[model samples]
Target: MPLNKTLSVLLLSLISGGALAAEAGTAFIALPGKAMLADAVRLAATVTAIDPATRTLTLQGDNGQARQVVAGPEVRNFAQIKVGDRVEVRLLESLSLELKKGGAGVRTRVDSVEAARAEDGSAPAGALARSTTVLADVIKVDAKTHSIELKGVSRKLKLKIDNPEQLKQIQVGDQIKGTYIDALGISVTPQPAK
Candidate 1:
C-alpha cells in the first residue's frame, strides 16, 4: 500500500499536464542512516478521451475518476491512442543503509541519469530514474524511543528505527550511508474487443 501511494504520486506528477516540461534527471545525497525501506507498484487505467492535436488523453480509473494527462514529444505514438486503449504505469523505489567500512572523512555522492527516447527524441514508453546516496555521521541514539539522529550531506535529522536490533548496529560518530532509487514508466495497449 505504501508503494502504491508512492507510485501514484510519482506517476501522476510526471504524467499530469503540470509536468509537461519535466525532463529526465538524477540526483544523489549522503547522510546518516536512521531507517531504510524499499518497494514497488504497478497500475493501469483505461483511456476515455484523446485529442491528438493537443497531445493529451483522459484516463478513467477503476474508481471512475477521470484524469487528464499530456504526452510530451517523447511519446512516439501519441497519435495511436484510442478511447478504449489501456495505459499502464510502473514505479520502483528502494533505500538501503550501510556503515562505512574502514573509511575516513567525507565521501562524495554518486548521481546518474538516463532516458529512453523515440527516433524523434521523444521519451515515449521510457523511464526516468534518479538514484541518490549519502554518507553521514551518527550524532545521537535513543534506545528507549527506537530512534537516532544523524548529520551528513546537508542538515541533521532524527528518525525512528523500525527494528530495535538495527539501532544496535550504529553508534555516535559512525558513518552511515544510504542509497535511494526511484523510477517511473508508462505504456499503452489496445483493449480487447468484447
Candidate 2:
C-alpha cells in the first residue's frame, strides 16, 4: 500500500492515543502536556540475503530469528544494499493535540515527506519520514458523558474525553488541531575487515 494510505490507517487506529505506550525496544515520551504522544524503536539486524531482481531481502534479527521483506517501489535505491551489511532500522511516531479557541468551523490538512539514501551509491541505506496535520471543528461536547465529537477532513469522530473537567472547558465550534508524524530509517554498514 501507498505510504499515505498506510499513514491514514495508522492515524485512524491511533485516534485512541492511550494505547500507544512503551514497548521493550521502543521508547515513549510525551511533552509536559497530556495531549502529546511519542514513541521510537531502534534495532540492528544483519542482512542475510538480498535479491536485487525481486527487491527482496532476508534479515536476521538479534534474537536469531530471520524474516524476509520486499522493498516497494518507494524504495528507489534497493540495489545498493548488500549481504553481511548491518541494517539499522529506526521507527518513530508522534501525535500532538491542541485546542484552537474561537476558530471557525473549518477543516484543514497538511502533509510532508522526506527521504535519503547512501551518498556513495554502493552502501545499502535509506530513510523516509512523513508528517500529517489536521485541524477540525468540535461539533459536540457532552459533559454528562464526557464524550466529544470532532468533524474534520469530511470525517466525523466521536471520542471519550479522559477528563471531565477538560470536557467541560471545551465547547462546540472549538477546534481540535492534531499533528502526527511517522518516520522510518534504514542504513547498511559494511562488515569490518575480518
**The best candidate in terms of TM-score:** 2
lDDT (C-alpha) at residue 145 in model 2: 74
Question: What TM-score does each of the candidates earn?
Answer: 0.71, 0.72
**lDDT to native, each model:** 0.65, 0.68
- Kindly give the stretch of ten consecutive residues in candidate 1 with the minimal lDDT sum: 17-26
Judged by whole-model lDDT over C-alpha atoms, candidate 2 comes out at: 0.68
Q: Evaluate candidate 1 by giving its C-alpha RMSD to the native, one decimal.
A: 8.1
- The sequence of per-residue lDDT tens digits that candidate 1 reaches over residues 1-194 is 33334334547754563323222323333344344465666666788888888877787765566778766554575666778887777667778778764353574578765555334433235566779887777778789999878786668778777676677777776777878788776667777878
Identify the leading candidate in terms of lDDT: 2
Candidate 2 colliding pairs: none
In model 1, pairs of residues that clash are 29-133, 29-134, 30-134, 30-135, 31-134, 31-135, 74-122, 74-123, 74-124
Q: Which stretches of candidate 1 lie over 4 Å from their true place?
A: 1-10, 13-36, 101-104, 118-124
